[model samples]
Target: MKTIKGNFIFDKEENKEKIDEFKKFIEKNKDRKGPLMPILQEGQNVFGYLPEEILKLISSKLNIPLAEIYGVATFYSQFTFIPKGKTDIHICLGTACYVKGGADILEEFEKRLNIKKGETTEDRKFSISETRCLGDCGKAPVVEINGKQLAHFTKEDVKKVLEKYK
Candidate 1:
């Protein structure tokens, strides 16, 4: 099986290095109080996204139930099960941004990228997601690409911004 972003599921052979890294992370941190969160975060960092195999590994090493691990991971919006594209786009939907045509900007991205929010393109070049706020209300309609913010973004700017990544 593969994830929506085309990452193979349970292909441990292909992910041996990342799995080893995650194992080291787990060994180094497993004894700490409240280690699950950090373990999961590091797992995501190492694997790009947490797959079932990693989750199961965590459960086995920590002796935590798989269901419990899933519960915690799912509760956090920061954890994503699917691989994010190389260029991740986040559009703010905060009140200020929405009022400034943020929705239109998001629509423009969807139209141009041919993928809805929370989905990565088939080629894995881009992924679109939305946030409630980007804390740049003054700029309104903020678009964040790989951690860099594009303030006062307009629908017309999407093409140019995407060109930079391409």
Candidate 2:
């Protein structure tokens, strides 16, 4: 099996709290297996993504194995093992947008925000990514700041937009 690469140190006390919370969550849905997803969802909400420590906690509480928890988390894309930023900046790299300077727009955001794709800024306010498409091709070269759409942008427009975020 390929290894999962991450470095999330766990505090035993915090893990215990999260474990207790997860137990309560599961008990609330004792009659239904459907609650497993929600149980894991709450876990992710608390710990950012399913870290080893969290998976172990869940396994211990649910009497499952760590491998199964990790497998389930990896099978789903929405389960992130790392912390996400407060604001997510998505730059569309669709064919039309890319041809019309989408790459440059992404670079501008990176330079201005000082963060590479899939990484949050040092202040934890901004996270940036080059996405396949945002479906705003009519306004080619589009970007979204914290899911607020901005279309038909140039370098100057990017600067103006970022000013508000900063």
Q: Write the per-residue lDDT of candidate 2 for residues 24-55, one digit (tens) a residue.
A: 87667645765557768888887666666666
Please report the candidate that would top TM-score against the real structure. 1
Clash pairs, candidate 2, are 49-80
TM-score of each: 0.88, 0.70
Q: Which stretches of candidate 2 lie over 4 Å from their true place?
A: 1-22, 34-36, 45-52
Model 1 lDDT per residue over 69-162, tens place: 9999999998988778899999999999999999999999999998899888877799999999989899988999999999889999999988
Residue 22's lDDT in candidate 2: 67
Cα deviation at 156, candidate 2, in Å, is: 3.5
Which consecutive 10 residues in model 1 have the weakest lDDT in total? 1-10
Candidate 1 TM-score versus the reference:
0.88
What is the Å distance of residue 80 in model 1 from its true position?
A: 0.5
